[model samples]
Target: MSFTLAIVGRPNVGKSTLFNRLVGKRLALVDDQPGVTRDLREGEARLGDLRFTVIDTAGLEEATDDSLPGRMRRLTERAVDMADICLFLIDARVGVTPSDEVFADILRKRAAHVILAANKAEGAAADAGVLEAYGLGLGEPIRLSAEHGEGLNDLYAQLAPLADEFEARAARDAPETDVEVGEDGDEGALPAFSDKRPLQVAVVGRPNAGKSTLINRILGEDRLLTGPEAGITRDAISIRTAWDGVPMRIFDTAGMRKRAKVQDKVEKLSVADGLRAVKFAEVVVVLLDAAIPFESQDLRIADLAEREGRAVVVAVNKWDVEEHKQEKLRALREAFERLLPQLRGAPLVTVSAKTGRGLDRLHAAILRAHEVWNRRVPTAALNRWLAGMLEQHPPPAPQGRRIKLRYMTQVKTRPPAFVVMCSHPDKMPDSYVRYLVNGLREDFDMPGTPIRLTLRGQGDKNPWKGRRKSQPSALRKHLKKGT
Candidate 1:
């Protein structure tokens, strides 16, 4: 296992910012509001030549067992236990508070290696607090500015030795293995990574859509906080596990309500965070209540996922409670086909998040959708299909000149994108593009996934094709001669 480092501190001390800097991506959302990060997020971190797994944890707090802050504290404690070292942060401008002291005591008792950091300590106003951090009893404080990229070298100096020691110990304990060589006898060549990346699925829908309940049913545990409350989930929490041997990462996002109704600042942040999760996900499962299926908001959510170029699976929740199963299923399918024709062939599975009914079907549908999304077609077959499409319903000619399509090729996949070399790209109507896209979907068994068909014309910019160019304007030629 790689060396692990966990960042733990009270709320709004720039812990998330430091996490982003180390991971070189903004995976964790950061804001001025306290308690913004409510879950632990892990990523590979790099500083100079050092590489380790860095986990960004929710800010620690002292609260009773049942409250939200208390739950977050418990989760952060789990992260501390999982790490090889802990970096406890304190805001230099504010100095140490009672909460910081309480957390320090806990980390001292629990963590094997503790590194203290005084953040936001760049200016003269923070001088006193920087000195105050020395009394935390962890060690000498590393005066760091996570946002401005300062004091990382000092922090690296402390981490380098620990990383080296960990590597040495691990190497000594590793089992002996034989190295395989290719026919060319390449020396010391490491084996290629054969394991595929886990498929990332994001579950999203309107408020109280049973998204969390469905995830719990799949995981067979109450890994998420689910209640009758509408907005209990505030952050996009990702859980990694295997579903029947298929490695997967599932994201449970906060329910998204319409913009006009979102008045609270926290809810607004929650919704934006959910949208980011959708963008990052490979397949998005739009869960809906069976009784109120195809609501305007539900349709909008599914449409957003489609537009984002993600594989979509429509899952109807609370199916166990429905009285008329056959009628409800038929009606839901018809409404889905009529309302979201763009995703015609996408999988629609019904499940009861509360009872776990139809979960096997849901799992199969997700795997199938993922497969179609990653499918590719050869260039020769694509051109042959294009010819058949043109023969059946030829493109329109706006000014008595028929548009000629010469070639077609699949440029990329993951919601397959294609480019067709045509006579006039700009003149191709939206209806025609839709016709081609639908044809691709029907002909290639690529239903329900987003398909992109772009028209490109040959580089000949001359407007007058197959016509003799008018002799260079006689007046222009005479003017050039005179000049």
Candidate 2:
């Protein structure tokens, strides 16, 4: 029932600013620099009482060839075709440039419904520019200031009627359903199938690792702009789809470089955004280049996912071009074990993001990793396993005092965490904790998933806890003696 509104303009015309204002969040990255947004980002927008879907697109460029800017232009044109309305924003401060006129012509032909907005029209300085915007012949330009939050009521007024029309069309096309509502407005007989929330997966790696290309293969469409350019994607773009019959919301994040090498402000923001995506993701696919597998940055990315307690699956991309596949895969497995001992048994899949080979195996690996990450062991089994491990290799006694582990229990899953009630929890060494963690992984078939082991020192119960102690007074003793 909702309509899609795409904001198209030349670079730095306040398109992303207006998008952030409408979405009520900084979903799209904004900067004074042009072309900061390279991919289309979608968000649910709310203005006044009207609601619709808003798309923040890359700046419309004049290039029509296979260059990066040309690819960006093609992607924006696709958005124009998909959107129900196109809100053309022009900089009131810079007035209408030649590029703006060109893009206006394109939108006039491509966009079904077009609304002209002269953004940053805050004061008298923007009045002449606003007047110039009318020469494009789209319509009367709405004088707007996205940064200052002015003229939004006019934007709302312009969109409300279009929203109504879309809703009317949706109602007319909607299929009829005969259903009964029970008390509290609940449906009495719902469908047998229940909707499950899609799994959240994020693909992250160093620059030019084919992260976007892999996701495009999964999506079966050119949903994101991809090229030989190292860092085309600037934001963590998430798309929802069904892959291998499993519903998933997959995030294609910007490539992360080392801290010392990153000097640009926009790249810094991009790296931070990718890190945030990893945190929100339940499963992280660490994509690596087949030609240069297990670089320092790749290891860092995988370790980061592990340290964040996310399910990790290592994938070597661009495998189709490899000549000695078996030798490379063997060396890859060896290096994975030697470098990332923490992620020892994790699934390492060889995939070709370009040719789309080995995707089925990658999907199976991801599901397996997720299952292992969420695997939980019962308390009885855990305690029994702990007893056996302790008997086999007892806890070290520091300074001739023996350490005692009384009980063990799994406190939580999702990178399954456990607690051990013991004596001298602080005295327990990291080596011992690793021992127990490795033991749990092996005994419980929880391979490659990060495990958290916590030791709590158990003390003797204090019977006098929470009770006030009364002392016998000397005066009371003397009175008793006199009596």
- Candidate RMSDs in Å, in order, are 6.1, 3.6
Residue pairs clashing in model 1 are 345-448, 346-448
Estimate, for each residue in 1-483, the C-alpha lDDT of model 2 and write its tens digit.
Answer: 679999999989989899999999887888899999989999889998888899999999899999999999999999999999999999998999998889888888888899999999998999899999999999999989999899999988899999899999999999999998656864666532222577899999999999999999999999999999899899999888889778898999999999999999999999988999999999999999998889999989999999999999999999999999899999999999999999979999999999899999999999999889888888999889999999999999999999999999988988899999999899999999999989988889988999999999888778788789888799999999999
Q: What is the alpha-carbon lDDT for the whole of candidate 1?
A: 0.90
Please give the clash total of every predicted structure, in order. Answer: 2, 0
Per-model TM-score, in order, reads 0.80, 0.93
- Using TM-score as the measure, the top candidate is 2
Per-residue error (Å), model 2, residue 144: 1.4
| Candidate 2 segments whose C-alpha is farther than 4 A from its true place | 177-196, 462-483
